[model samples]
Target: MGLRPQLMDSTRSQDQDQNSTQDATALIQQLEQDRAWLLEQIDRGRWQEFRLDLAALERELGQLLQRASEHFSSGSE
Candidate 1:
């Protein structure tokens, strides 16, 4: 019984980790897509709003990537 509970906990932890990884990947893809769209808008000279939005997006994307890197690396260790 004790060993079974430990196994269950380990499985749950793995599921949570997998979900987190998937969520992070999806977020990164969406952010990249948004960046591309914003860039196209900026290129067309829709300057002010899109540029600001892009800057904010870049910052968020950077932070998220850093966090994801840390999370995965820590998991490996």
Candidate 2:
């Protein structure tokens, strides 16, 4: 009986990990897109606001990666 619950818990954990991985992958794709946009903005000599937005997006991506790293590292235990 206890084993059944343990097994279920393990499965749930695996699912959560998979979900996190997917989220990370998606975020990376978004980051790439943002980077391309930033490059284009730079080439076109866009306004300062676009530059600021790019900076903010880069910081956000860094934070997200750090968060995911912490979650993955802790989850292993």
Candidate 3:
């Protein structure tokens, strides 16, 4: 009985981790797409308009990547 509950809890934890990883991946992909779109607009002479937005997006992406790296590394341990 005790072992069964422990196994269930472990399974739940793994499910949560998988969901979190998927969410993070989706977010990163979206951010990359947004960055590419912004760059395309800039190339078409919209630099001034999207410049600040691009910078912010880059910072957010960097932070997200850093957090993900840390999270996964720690999980591996």
lDDT values for all models: 0.74, 0.73, 0.74
lDDT per residue, candidate 3, 1-77, as tens digits?
77999999999999998888778767756766776776677567776767777768767776776687677557656
TM-score of each: 0.66, 0.61, 0.66
Candidate 1 lDDT over residue span 1-77, tens digit each:
67999999999998998888778767766766776776677667776756777667767776776677677667656
- Which is better, 2 or 3, measured by lDDT? 3
Candidate 2 overall lDDT versus native: 0.73
**Which scores higher on TM-score, 1 or 2?**
1
Worst 10 contiguous positions by lDDT, candidate 2:
68-77
Over 4 Å off in model 2, which ranges?
48-77
Model 2 C-alpha lDDT per residue in residues 1-77, reported as the tens digit of each score: 86999999999999988898778767766766776676677567777667777667766776776676677566656
